[model samples]
Target: MFGFGIPELLIIGAIVMLIFGVGKLPELGSSFGKAISNFRKAADGKDMIELNSKKDG
Candidate 1:
């Protein structure tokens, strides 16, 4: 894991918690997951955009 052991990861995680605080962590994680998901879809030649339309009668 890039030469990062448990102690180094703990320190890094602590720093992130201090910087972003506790509340914003889940929001950040959600955005990160979405970004990776989109990246994978694009890499796999899948359409990442959706369009919806309705016709009025």
Candidate 2:
């Protein structure tokens, strides 16, 4: 709730909707969700990193 009332939350939601628009809002939300997911996965050591080493002739 963050101490916000119905009216205050409505105002904030309206502003966010206006700024992002209904069409792109879902995409933004999905992207945010993915970023959070990836961060969590990395923290849990689930992310993979590849490194290549070259042999000297």
Candidate 3:
């Protein structure tokens, strides 16, 4: 992803550490996970709008 190799990945990780700090890694990871989950649900048309429409009819 993003055409990164080992060296590039390490550099990107270092930048993230600088930006977000080690103490916030878990919070960032969890929020990223939730965003990814929501993106997948949206792509599959399984989000709240779809559920509500199904219920109304």
Per-model TM-score on C-alpha atoms: 0.78, 0.69, 0.77
Model 2 misplaced stretches (Cα beyond 4 Å) = 1-6, 50-57
* Superposition TM-score, candidate 3 onto the true structure: 0.77
Off by over 4 Å in 1: 48-57
lDDT per residue (tens digit) for residues 1-57 in model 3: 778899999998999999999999999999999999999999997885633445555
User: Per-residue CA lDDT of candidate 1, range 1-57, in tens?
Assistant: 899999999999999999999999999999999999988999997955787888899
lDDT of 2 by residue, 3-55 (tens): 99999998988999999898998899999999999999999988978889999
Candidate 3 has an lDDT of: 0.91
Candidate number that wins on TM-score, 1 or 2:
1
For all predictions, the C-alpha RMSD in Å is 4.8, 2.2, 4.3
* Model 2 residue 10 CA deviation in Å: 2.4
Candidates' C-alpha lDDT: 0.94, 0.93, 0.91
List candidate 3 segments past 4 Å from native.
50-57
Which candidate, 1 or 2, would have the higher lDDT against the true structure? 1
Give lDDT: candidate 3, residue 50.
Answer: 35
